[model samples]
Target: MLANMGNEIYRKIEQVKLLPLYTATDLTYLDRLEDILVKNNVRFIEVTFRSDLAIEAIKKLSQSNELIVGAGTVRTQKEAKDAIENGAKFVVSPAVVPEVIEYCIEQDVPVFPGTATPGDIQRAMEYGIKVVKFFPADIYGGLKAINALSGPFYDVKFLPTGGINEENFMEYVQNDHIVAVGGSFIISESLIKKDDGETADKALKSLIDKINLQK
Candidate 1:
C-alpha cells in the first residue's frame, strides 16, 4: 500500500524525512515549518540528532502532538534512545548497521535504516526488515537503483531519500515498489531563514497536494 507503509516503513519515514534543519538562524524557525507541515497534510517528520538543539526541538514538536515524529541520521544507540526518550515515534539512519537496526527491532520501536546497494539491502533483509531507506539516492542511480533492486527483492519496499525533490518526486513514488521518498527539498533551510513562513508553508502544501493528486 502506498499509504504510509508496511505499511510499516511510512510510520518510519514521517519521523525521518521531515527532519528539517535551521539555516544560520534562530530556533524559532521550527514554528513556521510546523505550521507548514501541519497545513500541508505532511503526516511525518524526520527529527535527526544532528541539529544543534535536537532534544529540545523533539520535545517541542512532541508538544504539538500532531504528525508521526521520528529521529534521523541516527548513528549510535545512545542517539536512538535520546530521540525516543524525547518523544520520537521511530528511528532512521543514513546507512545500515546491524546492531542499530536490531536495537530498534528489539525495542519494537520501528526503524528505517538506509541502503544503497544490493549488499546493503541484503543486510537489511538478513534481519527480516521489510522497509528501508535508499540513501544517496541520486548518486546511486536514483530510480534505477530501486528498479534494479525490485528485480530480486520484490517484497522489500523503499523510501528513497537524499536527492529526491519536486521535479522527480512523483516519478519515483508513482512506481509500484517505491513506498515513499525523503528529502529536505520540499521544506528547505533557506526558506526557513528568510522568515517567509507562509510562502514556505504554501510550497510544502503544494508538494503534498501534488503527491496525493489523482492520475
Candidate 2:
C-alpha cells in the first residue's frame, strides 16, 4: 500500500513508458531482449517467473546497470521474496494478495497489485496503496475506465497492462495518472521465436522515440 507515494512512478513511467516484459522461461531468448533494451537505451524490463529459469534470468539481467528490472506475475509472499532476493527491484501481480502486499511494504519494495473494478480498488485503498495495476486493461474498458476512476480516485496511479500496445500506447502513457505500461510488444512472441535481435532493437528504440516524441 504505497498510497502516500506520489507520481514518482509516473516519472518512472516517463522514463520507461515503453518496456519489454519477458514473461516466461527461456534464458536463451532474453539475450535478444537484453540486447534491444541496451542498444536502444530502453529503460525497464519485467522478468516474470512464469517459467523454470526466472531466478537465473534475473541474475543474468542484474549485471546490466541500466535496466530497471521487475518481477511480474508474482503471487505469493515467497515469490516476492525470491524476486527481491534474486535482483528484482519491484514486483507486480495480476491479482490482490494481502500477505504479498504487506511483505513488499515491509521489505521496501514497490508492488503493483492488480485491480479492475471500483470495489477492487476500494479493497486496495484499504491497504493505503496509491499505485495499482489496471489488469486486463482493455477488458476493463481501458482508458475510459481509468478516466472514470479519476473522479473518485484522483490520487491513484496506474501501470496499465494486458492489451496495452504500440498502436494504443500513447492513449495510456499520455494520461496524467498512468505511470507506465507492461507489454510484450518490445519483445513479442514472434520476435523471440525468430530470435530477431535486430528487429527487437529497432522496435524498442522506435517505441521509446515514439513515447518521447509525444512528451
Candidate 3:
C-alpha cells in the first residue's frame, strides 16, 4: 500500500517534467521562488536540507496546496521524520540510506534517493524504490549512464540532477526512462541572492518558452 502511494506521487512529478532543486540559506526567497515557478507553469520545488532553515522553508511553502513542495538532501531517519512533520509531501536523499528509506516507507511518503553505480540502484530496488535521483549527472556520463542502466533496470525511472542547465536539460528529460530533470539552473543561488524578481522572471520565462516550444 505504501509503495502504491509512492507511485502516485511519482506520477505527479513525471507530469511536471521539471523539478527545481533549490538551496537557500534565507527563508525570504521561498515565496518569491514560488511566484516565479507558478508564473512559469511549474508546480513543484525541492527545498534542500543543506541549510538550518530548510524545515522552516518547507513548512512555510507547504501552506499553499497549489505548490508541490518537498525536502531534498535528507540524510538521516530523523531528518525524514522531521520533514514529513513539517508538511513535506516527499523526501529526497543525496544517497540511499536503508534506515531513512524505511522511515519514509513507514510514513508512506515518497522518496527519491541518489544512486550512482549499478550497485546503488540495485540496493535501492531491494528497498522497493522504483524511482531514484541520478546525482552529478553530467560527470556521471548523463544520458549515457541512464541508457546503460535502462538495459538492466527496465522497470526503474530516474530524475537526473546536478550540473543540469537550460542549455542541455531537454537531453535528459526527453528520454522515457527519465521521470524529470532537477537543477538550480532556473533558480540558482546567485539569482536568489540578487532578489531581483524582474531578472529572475526573464530567465524563467526564457526557459519555459523553450520548453513549450519543444513540446
Candidate 4:
C-alpha cells in the first residue's frame, strides 16, 4: 500500500507549515512566481487546475527539485491521472470523490480529498485516507469544525483551504490537527500580472517571516 511507503505529504507540511494555493490563467508569470515562492522558503505549493495553463505549469515547476508541486481542484479521475503523469507530487480536491481517491491510491500518489461533514470523513476513512482538506473552512465554522471532528476522527489530519488569510492562518496552524493551511490572498493574481515579481516577493517574504516568528 502507498500508505506504508510513508506519507510524503505530511512530511513536507511538517517541514514548512504553509501551502500557497496558486492559480494562473496566464503562463507568462509562472517562472517569476515560482522564484518568489522559492525565495520565501516555501517548499510546497499547489498550482490549482483552474486554468488551461495549469498542467503545463505543473510540468515546468516540478522539473525543479527545490519545490514539491501539487495539483489542486482536481475533480475527476482523468485530471488526477494527468496531473500525476505530468509530475505533480500530490493531488487535492475541493470535495470527496471516491474514484479520484481510489485512482490516486492505486497509483501510489498522495491525495488530500475535501471533507466537510462527518459522512465525508467517514467515507474517506473507508478509503484509508489519512489526510483531507477542510474546504471553505471559514464559512463552515473554521477551527470549530476541526475540533468537532477530532473527537471521532482523531487520526485524520487536515489541510484547511478557502477564506484563509494572514490574520486567521496562524490560528489554524496553531492546531496540531491541521497539517497545513492553503491561501492565495497574499499571492494575488493581480500581483502576478505585474511580471517583475517585486510585489509578490514582498508579500511572500512577510508571510514567511510571520510563520517563522510563530515557530
Q: Against the true structure, what is every candidate's RMSD?
A: 3.7, 2.2, 1.4, 1.4
* lDDT tens readout by residue for model 2, 89-172: 778888888888888888877788889988878877787777788999999999999999878999787778898877888888
Backbone collision tally, model 1: 9
| Tens digit of per-residue lDDT, candidate 1, span 90-193 | 78888997667767776777787889988999988887777888888899999887898999999888888778777888787677787677777777657766
Lowest summed lDDT window (length 10), candidate 4: 1-10
Name the TM-score of candidate 3: 0.94
Task: Please report, as a residue range, the 10-residue window in candidate 1 with the lowest summed lDDT.
Answer: 16-25
| Residue-level error in angstroms, candidate 3, position 53 | 0.7
Q: Summarize candidate 4's per-residue lDDT along 23-126 as a digit string, tens digits.
A: 87877777787788788878788889898888998888888777889999999999999999999988899899988898989888888899899998898888
By TM-score, highest first, what's the ranking? 4, 3, 2, 1
User: Model 2, stretches more than 4 Å misplaced?
Assistant: 1-10, 193-195
Candidate 4 ranges beyond 4 A from true positions = none
Candidate 1: list runs displaced more than 4 Å. 1-25
Candidate-wise lDDT, in order: 0.72, 0.77, 0.86, 0.85
Tens digits of per-residue lDDT, candidate 3, 72-172, equal 99999988998899989998999988888999988888989999889999999998888999997988989999999999999999999988888998887
Clashing residue pairs found in predicted model 2:
3-130
Native-to-model Cα distance after best TM-score fit, residue 211 in candidate 1, in Å: 1.8
Model 2 accuracy (lDDT, Cα): 0.77
Structure candidate 1, residue pairs in collision: 5-8, 14-44, 14-45, 15-45, 15-46, 15-70, 16-46, 18-46, 19-46
